[model samples]
Target chain A: MKLQRELQIVNRLGLHARACAKLVKTANQFESDIVLRQNEHQADAKSIMGLMMLAATQGTRLTVITSGADAEDAMTQVQHLINNRFEEDE
Target chain B: MLSLSGTGIGRGIAIGRAIVLDQGHNDIPCYRISATALSGEIERFNHAVDAVRADLKRVQRNLPTDAPPETSAFIDVHLLMLDDPVISQQPVQTIQEQQQNAEWALKSHADTLIDFFEDIADPYLRSKKNDVAQVVGRIMGELAHSPGKQPSDLATLGSSLAEQIIVARDLTPADTIMLRGRNMAAFVTSLGGPISHTAILARSLGLPAIVGLHDVIDTIHNNDLLIVDAATGTVLVAPDEPLLAQFRELQQQHLRHQQRLTLLKSEKAVTQDGEAITLLANIELPEDIEGLRSAGAAGVGLYRTEFLFMNRPKPPSEDEQYQAYCHVLRRVEGPVTIRTLDLGADKQVDGGRPDRETTATSALGLRAIRLCLSEPSLFKPQLRAILRAAVHGDAQIMIPMLSSLRELEQSLALVGEVCAELEREAVAFNPKVPLGGMIEVPAAAVSADLFARKLDFLSIGTNDLIQYTLAIDRVDDSVNYLYDPLHPSVLRLIRTVIRAGHEADIPVSMCGEMAGDPAFTRLLLGLGLRHFSMEPSQLLEIRQQVRQSTLAGLSGQVTDILNCVETGSLYDLVDQLNQTDSD
Candidate 1:
């Protein structure tokens, strides 16, 4: 059930506190181990502080890796959230 | 020995011991822990973390429904940070592997985290370092104040904060709400302005506050005697005996002035020419009834029902709302004007109701009466509750933000439907409860005659009326100077609403900040406004102003003020109206 994909951050403010909070909340909803990797920097998807530490700005591409029974579903939601720009009007 | 100054909220003074909170990280004790005592130290650290987590959860759970969305969002980030393994686990490792004390270990990890954030190129992300520091500071505060000390001393530390003046870099809305019930003497903060939540809360609670006192925490230590002169926006720390005695006398005089005002509580609010004024109190919580009684107010003028709907997972059921409304209804002696859910703009509630979420910006969006009408599940329970609660006492329903006759017609229809449903269920309710409208929206004020013919009474909420008319957000500190209540347009609207009430033979009451302000007391009386509802703390002061005025002489001055073409002279004219010897 392992899945991996490259996703682009489309939101203008990138991963700010509110954005990170939204991402972490969505990632915590599934049983998958979600992680994001960007240029040798990796962050656990469930950790807001870790997501913030990546300093991923708009247009930055990150590789998402999910592994668990619900890995595919988690990956789909994570992709949808980023594609929708975290529901923010940027 | 030291002095600091800031903007003061009120003209009150307080003398109390300092309780410095969230001080900078230069003073943390870093001592070597014995090998055998490591487990005890680790246990103490764990307990402090758990205590802080519990405290944060409690604050989140009890958040006022009207708190801005950012307040909850900020707390959520801090809560998530607390759960992150980097924060929760790394400090434990530092304590165990490096044999460092708990405070030292946490500070080391926090510094590392802060450095990582500081290196981020984005300015917004760099500010996240402050969040890390604040989270760590909370834990540090808990450690310094709680369990590691002797058990008997723990009780004293916990109970003594009520008497001390809180000094901090700044206070969040959550912090202010948590401190609201405590009998704290005053607040001195390093940041904030007149419109900040801290200042607003202090004014509502009738306490003195000094905000914008930069780096106040560094100079004031715990248990240091200090004098907070809010009149001059000064904090005198560790003063000598002579200075202390001088301030003590001043504090006594300030208190005696307040005591003197209380003597007017039982007196009627009437002009010298035999015109009587109805004075009422605006309240949010049922406990405010205590102040209403103490001030000898006529009754609850505007009882805000939003507190019942905020900070919870879901809206209250019909029975629950009924019980809450009845609790306030049975306690009050006169008519209670309970405004329906004015939940929009900055006062949105996060009670898990999805319908309240709108795409438009809050100010001009679907809120108040519009939101209620669109969502019957949200509106009907409140209507049914207010009707049922009216059996206990004189309760009236007031609708807020009604703009046009179409909305009024729809609102009346919905009320009719609720009445039919309640009657079908054989609910013991009073259907004769008067329905009033808050003339806060500009359109409603302009069409006051039409609305007055339909509604039973009209209450002018000047806060929103002024904001809507001037196109200025009162909370925005940059533009607040332009929020003049004496503006010609604002006065004309007030006059229009009052005249409509007089023509329709109904009472027009004002329940805004303008009504409570003593300077505007005579001006409002001159404009034919006889009913005034304000904060209970201001009731006696306004009553004294009412008793000293002669209504027979105000009409000519008011006519001059209304016809005033120049803006600069409007204030002078109002000041002259307040002068008893001028006429």
Candidate 2:
């Protein structure tokens, strides 16, 4: 079973390199095939290189799709991270 | 002679022989290898990778745990990528299939990755090229069995180039970090910007460097006599003896000036008319006290307590703070003004990882007293510690960035409350510990009299005062040129603040970089500033300047110079004053 949720970026600095590292770290916590997408660009949430290609900016919405036994858990954590704005820019 | 212009790192100069460092990896030779040597080549590659990994791990271990996590993350990402099929496994497969040498195989994979990163749309991601290049450089370095140049060639010239200047096309941050321990005279690169990582590291290491000189590597050769005048961004190559001799004289004068300063370490910072000015030292770390004592300091004027709050998991407990304060108070017989935890933006207390690059607005952000006052829990523990330390000796409490009378009143009231708490706990402490505020902000300087009337003493923190007054970011290299202490407005403000303190019957002291500089010692004296606290390294030089100056009519001359300022021409007066004194 695959679970997916779309959320809008809220941090002041957006999905820059630091935020990408943070996203990658959180996504790797679960045993799920995670993919993040913005417009036509899609990246493996586990890869720093893949996420860098997404180039998601503030106000841009990203879809988080995970397919594995822990898909729901990965979705919850990544959504929580996105909602909190990466703890950047107050 | 050849001339080149570039972005200068700092205002420093160096004259030395040139040593070209061809750190660029584009020139590495690549060739097909025999099947018999394939496994040996692969083995060599693995050994090199392990060595580089060990080096990177050591760097990670050396970094302070509390350092901004990104710093460690930077190396960690590279380490992780090293295990990736793209970096670690791809090149090995390429070596077996293509019959290519290990160096060439690695380069082939790196080139493909570099092209991919370059094609990334975001400029931020595009900068990842440097990281890839650095990682590849290390691997190449391993294959070549040397870091900067081929080892076989370096064996002869390395010793000869020990006292040489490095001229390179460009330098990555990792390359500089790797070579930071080398005692090179200076660095002249063909590329950099003022606030770039390269420039920041150069400034921190106090290395004279100039960058962005197009074709610098092309124009200069090995062993060429190069004059790196970083102050002016001018590189003189094989200059005539007359010019070389002039620079040599200046260098000797610089050395002699240092000798003269050391001689003044034991002398009194007294005026010709016999007025004994109290010259103190500003200390940060506990070890600074040793130098302070050796320099014959009268006392510690500003004991910044920020060190206790930095690079830690949480804020120091009151007892921990008290112990550190007691250590300093025990060493100094003279009074030590313990400035409370100047926290908030620049200095983190909430365990936030330190950022590699300081944001432009951190100076104006909630930092120093602003951070402490807003977070009373942070402020109270430090206040309690300082109060407790007072029982050991003459320890005074000082508040930083007190912009308004209300802030000062609130801080003092808090101090009073802490003292009462100590009393209630039956703790022995100096209840009447002297309280003062740092007059750093322009508003504080303008309202100096109001503060002087209430506080025991006034200390002018000119570093921030100048920046705040001029609205210039001193750390920002572009506008930092305008951070002039001699600006007419700045001089007048210092004069007004000093005058206000005197009228209110308070002793005024200045603790800033300007206070330590020998050039401004006479001007500060002329402005009636009798108290000064500076770095231990500068204490002797300032003392020497103070001893040579006569108070008689000095104020009149300084006043005349202050009036002569016609916007940015204040340096002329400084030159004129120094010229007359030398004559």
Candidate 3:
């Protein structure tokens, strides 16, 4: 199964190192292969270097693609993390 | 002698030799590897990565339970980088395809990642390159088999570096955490401002640190004798013998002074005449609570809430403010006086409202109670939060810079309005929480008796009161010398406020720099300032002074000091007052 959705980075510091680490940790938790695409740049969601390379600042929208048996759960969890501003205060 | 200066973290002095941490990025050997040697080089690369992983994990496992979650999260980022295919597999591909040495291949791949981060537009995201460099640096150190390049090595060389100052380009959170449990004398970093991780860690640990000393790592070397005076942010290298002797003497005196003050921590802040004085802490950050606890303060007298509202794009929500207030309330044992939003003036809140920007530029402009009164959307949430958080402990609201009875009435009405709103929503709040005012404005100080009648308590903010009474901008170096706290008008205003609080039967506290000054402790006591609030560090020192004074004998000298015509004579009288009071 495969699913796709777009989410915005809303945290104050954007997808900085820690936030990227959080995203990668969440992505690696499932069997799904997750990839995030921001504009022309696409990166494996499980790669902190890839996410950092995208340089997604606050309000940058990225298309997230999850494909596997647990695609639904992965999508749900990834969406929740981004929307929660990576659990950062402000 | 050569000296470098930067912002100091705490009031500490250390004399030691220096040990510089080279981030190990300067030199890299680029060379071709023979086919057979290429495979061995790749294995060597894998081994280094694994070693760094174990080292980082060891540091993580041994972290103090009290370390902030961010510290672990920081190490997690590097750990994840170690596992990520971009970092782990790319260098192997480089070694296999290019037949390059492991160090050269890894450095090339790491440089690509760091260069990508550098091109990012956002400054914050751009700085994330440091994390990548730190992780790569660790692996590089492992590959080189250098002993002291890795921070984990600090633990292994603990005894040798124990009496030496650590000079680093910058310290990662993990480095700081590892250094915390060590007996390193001080830290001098080539990078970082006052709010950086190194600065915060040094302050919390009471370790002397000087940061933002650019190129300091290159300037100092291992075994270079050094003197660190954090009070002046000075790091002196190889001072002359006579100057070294002088500093050694000063260091001894400082140690003796701190030891003497520490002995007074458990003693009550009461005069020799048997009058008990309340010595509370003026807290700006949550970290200050530790200092307050160690100093044995009565409670938090002025909890500045402006810090919550500043440095953010939007004002904190009502829930956030309530949680923050409750955090302090639960930690404190006695009354915690939460000062309402004192933003504007010099403290410009970034995203509060673009329209209010112009008004916030001047000291006398729309600020403090004025700004809060004009913007109910900004003010109501704080009012509601304080009222609700009051349920958790003895919380009191103290409004700042209340210059008139009309503003006081408007503030009170807003509080009432907030209470009604909370009631409508059926929220649990302390409706009877004490409401106080800061008597900083000369007008408010003059008419403090009237305001005292309407308020629960009053606190004299002598810093602002002295600044305004003397019409001097304390920040301006030219006129600050004239900014005298002992000016006749300033003394009269303080006296008036104290007398008014006495007559109105309300507690009057001084929550300014003056309250903590031992020179003025007796003077204020003579003028009847029974409640004092100051920085947590000053509490014990002030307590020592308070324990030696008899208020009965001070009154006569205080009157003379107050009536003295010349500033010179006034200072002389105060000196005489302190001289006679010494047991």
Best by DockQ: 3
In candidate 2, position B461 carries an lDDT of: 87
- Cα lDDT listed for each candidate: 0.83, 0.75, 0.83
- Give the range where candidate 1 chain B is weakest over 10 consecutive residues by summed lDDT: B148-157
Candidate 1 per-residue lDDT, tens place, B1-583, comes to 8888887877788888876664343478565555766787788788878888898999999999999978888888888888888777788877788877788889998999999999999998899999999989998878876544211121143543565787766665445545656788898887766655577567667788998776554566556688899999999987899998998899899889999999998888877888889999988777788889899999888998877776666888889999999998889899999999987666666652555465454567778888888888899899999999999999999999999988888888888998999899998989899999999999999999999999999999988898889987644545655777888899999999999999999889998878888889999998989999987878988899999999887977998999999988988899888986532
Candidate 2, residues B53-154, lDDT tens digits: the string is: 998999999998679967987786667556545667778888788877678899988898788778867676577767778888888877776322221232
Pairs with steric clashes in candidate 1: B65-B310
Please name the candidate that would achieve the greatest TM-score relative to the true structure.
1
TM-score of each: 0.66, 0.60, 0.57
Clashing pairs in 3: none
lDDT score at residue B224, model 3, on the 0-100 scale: 66
Per-model fnat list: 0.68, 0.11, 0.84
Q: Backbone collision count in every prediction? A: 1, 2, 0
Interface CA root-mean-square deviation for model 1: 0.7
- Per-residue accuracy of model 3 over B1-583 as CA lDDT, tens digit each: 7898876766788889887664554466455665766777788889989999999999999999999989999999999999888778999999899987677888898989899888888898899899899999998878766432222234355544677888877775546645645678898887765545576557545678887777654566555689989889999987789878888898888889888889888988888878999999988777779889999999999998876765568889999999999999999999999999887765677645546665636768788899889988999999999999999999999999999899999999999999998999999999999999999999999999999999999999987898889887643434534767889899989999999999999999999878876778888988889999987877887898899988886777777877888867888887777777586
Q: What's model 1's lDDT at B324?
A: 90
Q: For every candidate, what is the interface RMSD in angstroms?
A: 0.7, 2.7, 0.8
Question: Could you give the CAPRI-style class of model 3?
Answer: medium
Q: Please give the DockQ score of every candidate, comma-separated.
A: 0.51, 0.13, 0.55
